[model samples]
Target: MVAPLKVGIAGLGTVGAEVVRLIEAQQSILSARCGRGIKVVAVTARNKSKKRGIDLRGIDWMKDPLAVATHPEVDCFVELMGGAGDPALSSISAALAAGKSVVTANKALVAKHGVKLATLAEKHGGALNYEAAVAGAVPVIKTIREGLSGTSINRVYGILNGTCNYILTRMEQEGLSFAECLKDAQRLGYAEAEPSFDVDGYDTAQKLAILASLAFGTKVNESAVSVEGISTIAAEDLRAAADLGYRIKLLGVAMRTKTGIEQRVHPTMVPLTSSIAQVMGVTNAVTIDGAGIAPITLVGPGAGGAATASAVLADVADVARNVRALPFAQPVAKLKTTTKAPMERHEGGYYIRLMARDLAGTAARIATRLAEQKISLESIVQKHPNGGLEPIDGTKKSSPVPVILITYATSEDAMRRALQAVQKDKVISGKPQVIRIEKN
Candidate 1:
C-alpha cells in the first residue's frame, strides 16, 4: 500500500484550523480518492496557546511558518497565513526549492509574485497549487487551467469580491446607500475594519490578474487592471439601472481586445437577465466565454472558513495524488508580459446620470455636447425630485433634475470628452455618475 502523504500547515487561523479538521474528518474518503492517506504532521501559528477548538494532540507544533514549510517529514507545505510578502513568500519559496509541493490561499502573493514562484516550482519539479487564491470554492482556477485547456478563451469575468457584491445587492434590492450597506457588512463580519482593500476594487483586481494570466497565457500583472470601487455608487444609480432593465454589480472583467487584453474592475450595469446579475449577496460567480462552447458560469460561496478550506483541501488532494500542473497553466518562460490597456480607448455602452441644473437650455446644451462627440443615445429619462417623470417641455424649476441617458456603443474617450464639455457648460449641478454597460 502507498504510504500516507505528510502535510505541514502554516498559520492555524480560521482557514488553517478548518483544513486540519477536514483532513481528520475525511481521512478515509481522502485516502480512498488519492490511494494514500493525507496526514497533517506539523503546524505553526502566532499564538499556539490560544484555543482554536481543534485537537492538535498528535501533530507536531513547529516554531514558525518557515519551520513548518521545511519540516523534514512534510511532503506538502500549506500556507494559510496571508500576506504579499515575508514569511509566507519565503516559506513557499523554500518549500518549492526543496522539491516539495505547496498550496496556498493568498491571492495578493500569487498576483504579485506568481510568475517568479511558478518559475521556482517549475525548475524544482514540485507542484504549486493555489485553487483557493482566486474565487474561494468556485473551482474557477481548475476549470480554466485543466477543463478548458484545449478551448480558446476570449473572455473571463465575474463577481469576484463578496463584500462589494453584498453591498451592491443590498443597495439594489432595498435602495440602501453604499455607506449603509458597507456598515452592515462590517457588523456581519463580511468586511474588514479598514475596508478599503475590498471596497476599493484592489482585491478583485488581484484575483483578476491571476485569472487573466491563466486564461490568456500572460504573466500575472495586477497593475494592468483599471480598478474603480463601489464607494461612488449611489442608490439613485442602482434605481436608474433597474429602470433600464439592468442590475449594478462590482465586476472584474478581462477580455481579449484588438489592441490586447483589457482587464478592469468597476461597478458595471449587467442586464437583469444575465447569469452574473442573478448572483447576489456574498455568493460568487465566474463566466468563461470560450471560442465555440457556450458561456460556462460557476457559482458558489466565495468566502468563509468552510468554503475556503474546501478549496485548500482540493489542492492538497492533487498534491497527495502526485498531480503536478504548471502553476499558471503554462511554462514561466513562455508566459507573455502584458501592459495595462488604455481605459480611455475602451469601447462599450454607457449609463450616464447627470443631475441637470433646472435651467431652460440645460437639456439642449447636454444634447449638443453629446452630438458633437458623435454619441448616440439609446434612451433618456428625466425624473423629478419626487420620483415622478418630468414633462419633456415643462416649465423650469429651482431643483436639479435627474437626467438618465443610456448610450449606444461608444469609445470611453468620446464619453469623457462629452461629459467634460457638459460640465464646463455648467449644465449639470454635480459630477455625473457613470456606469459602464457590460453585455452578456
Candidate 2:
C-alpha cells in the first residue's frame, strides 16, 4: 500500500472539529477508496485548551496558524477558517506558494479572490479544491466543474442560504411574521447573533459569484450580483404567493444572457409544483440548466457539522487520488472577463401588489399606466377591503383595497416605469411590492 497521505487542519470550529472526528472514524473506508490511508498530521485553533471530543494523539499541535499550512510532513492544507481576509487569505497563499494542495470550505475567500489564488495553485502544481464552499454538502460545485463538463450551461441557481430558507419556510407554513420566524431561527441556532450577513443576502451573493464562475467559465465577480433580502417579505406576500399557485424562496440565480452574465440574489416566486419550492426548512436545492439535457436539480442538507465535514473529506480524498483540475473548471487564461448584465435588461414575469382607494375607475387607471409602458398583465386580482371606513363630512368614506397584478414577460425597466406612472396618479398608497417570478 502507498504511504498514508498527511493532512493539516486550521480553525477547529464546529465543522473543523467534526472533520477531525470523521476522518478517524472513516479511516478504513477512506483508505480503501483512495488506495491509501488519509491521516490528520497536524491541527491548529484559537484555544488549545478547548475540549474537542476527539483524540489528537500523535498529531503535531501548532500554535501559529500559518505553520500548519507550511508544515514539512503536511501534504494538504485544510482551511476551515471562515473569513475573507487576514489569516485565511495569507495562510492559503502561503500553502500554495509552498506547493502544497489546499482544500477549504471558505466561500467568502473563494468568491472574493478565487482567480488569484487559483493562478498561484496552478503555478505551483498544487490542486485547490473547495467542495464544501457552496451549499454545504450538496456537491453542486463538482457537478458543475466536472459532471457537466462537455455541456454548455445556460443557467445555475438555487436556495443557497439555509438561515433565510428556514425563516421563509417557517413564515409560510406557520403563518408567522418575519420577526417571529427570525427569533425562532435564532433560538434554534439556525441564525447568527448578527444575522444580517445571511438574511440581508450578502452570503447568498458570495456563493452565487463562485457558482457563476464555474457555470460560465468567467472570473468570480462578487460585487456584480444584485441582492435583496428576505427582511421585507411579509405574511401577506406569502398568502399572495399561495393564492397564485406559487411559493416564495430566497434564490441565487446566475444566467448567461445575450449581453453578458446576470447574477442576482433575492426573494423569488416559484411555482408551487416546482421541485425547488418543495425544499423547505434549512435544506438547499440547486438546479443546473444545460443544453442537450434536461435541467438537473440537486437537493440535500445545506449545513451542519457532519454534512460540511463530509464535503471537506470528499475533496481531501480527491486530492489523495491525485486528481488535478482547474478551480473554475477551465484554464485561467481562457476564463473570460465578465460583463455584468444590468437589472433593467432582465426579462421576466413579475408579481406586483398595490394598495389603492376602493373606488370605480381606480383599476382602469392602473391598467392605463401599465399600458403606457406596454406591460401586459397576466392576471389582476382585487382583494376585499380591509375594513369599513368612517364617514367624513357626511360623505361616503372609501377604504384602501389590495390590488395584485401578475404581469406577462416584461423588462424590469418597463415595470419600474409603469409603477412610477401608477404612483404618480395618486391612486396608490405606500411603495408597491414587487417580486420577480421564476417559471421553472
Candidate 3:
C-alpha cells in the first residue's frame, strides 16, 4: 500500500474541528477509496487546550501555523484560518512555495487572491483545492470546474449567503419586517452580531467573483461585482412580490452579456415556480445555464460545521488520490481578462414600486415618463393601504397611494432616466423602490 497523505490543519474552529472528526470517522473508507490513508499528522489553532469534541491524541501540535505549512512531514496544508490577509495568505504562499499541496475553506482568501495563488501553485508543481469556499456542501465549484469543462456556460447564479437567505425566508414566511427577521437570525445564530458582510451582500459578492471567473474563464475580479443587501427589503415589498407570483431572494448572478460579463449580487424577484425560489431558509441553490444542457440547479445547506466539513473533506480526498487539475480549471495565463459590464447597460425586467400622489392624471404622467424612454410596462397597479382611496390625512387631493409597475425588458439606463423624469414631474413621493426581475 502507498504511504498515507499527511495533512496539517490550521485553525481548529467549528469547521476545522468537524473536518478532523470526519476524517477520523471515515478513515477506513477514505483510505480504501484513495488507495492510501488520509491522516491528520499535525494541527494548530488559537487555543491549544480548547475542547474540540474530537480526540487529538497522537497528533503533533504546532505553536505557529506557518510552521505546520512549512513542516517537513506535512505533505498537504489544510488552511481553515479564513482571512484575505495575514497568516492565512502568507502560510498558504509558503506551502505552495515549498511544493506542498493546499486545501482551504477560505472564501475571502480565495476570492481576493485566487489568481496569484493559482499561479504560485502551478509554478511550484502543487495543487490548490477549495471546494468549500463558495456554496457550502454544494458542488457548484467542482461542477463548473470539471463537469462543464466542455460546455459553453452562459450564466451561473444562486443564493450564496445563508444568513441573508434565512433572514429573507423568515421575513416572507412570517410577514415580519427585515429588522425583525435579522434580529431573530442573530438570536438563532444564523447571523453574526456584526452581520454586515453577509447581510450587506459582500459575502455573496466575493463568492460570485470566484464563480464568475471559473464559469467565464476570466481572472477573478471581486471589485467588479455590483452588490446590494437585503437590509432595505420591507414587508410591503415581500407582500407585493407574493402578489406578483414571485419571491424576493438575494442572488449572486454572473453571465456573459453582449458588452461583457455581468456579475452582480442583489435582491432579485424570481418566479415562485422556479426551482431556486423553492429553496428557502438557510439553504442555497446554484443554477448553471450552459449549451447542450438544460439549466441545472444544485441546492443544499450553504453553511454549517458538518456541511462545510463535507466539502473540505472532499477536497482532501481528491488530494489523497493525487487528483490534479488547474486551480481555476484552466491555466492561469490562459484565463482571459474580461471586460466588466456596466450596470447601466444591463437589460432586464424590473419591479418598480412608488408612492404616487393619488390625484387625476398621476398615473398618466408616470406612464408618459416611461413612454418617453421607450420603457414598456407589462402591468400597472394602484392600490390604497386601506380598502378605498379615501385620504388618511383628511385631504382629498394629496393622499400618497402605492403604485406598483412591472416593466418589460429594458436597459437599466433607460429605466433610471424614466424614473428620474417621473420624479421630476412630482408624481411620486420619496425614492422609488426598484428590484430586478429574473426569469429563472
Pick by TM-score: which candidate is best? 1
- Model 2: pairs clashing at backbone N, Cα or C within 3 Å: none
lDDT of candidate 3 over 324-362, digit per residue (tens)? 889999999999886557889999999998988877778
Q: Which ten residues in a row have the lowest lDDT in candidate 3?
A: 387-396
Q: What is the lDDT of residue 183 in candidate 1?
A: 94
Query: For every candidate structure, what is the RMSD over all alpha carbons to the true structure, in angstroms?
Result: 1.2, 3.3, 2.5
Q: Rate the local accuracy (lDDT) of all candidates.
A: 0.94, 0.91, 0.91
Q: lDDT of model 1 at residue 5?
A: 95
Residues 245-346, candidate 2: write the lDDT tens digits.
999999999998878899999999999998999999999999999998999999998899989999999999999999988999988999988856789999
Q: Which pairs of residues collide in candidate 3?
A: none
CA displacement after TM-score superposition, residue 16 of candidate 3 (Å)? 0.8
TM-scores of the models, in the given order? 0.98, 0.97, 0.97
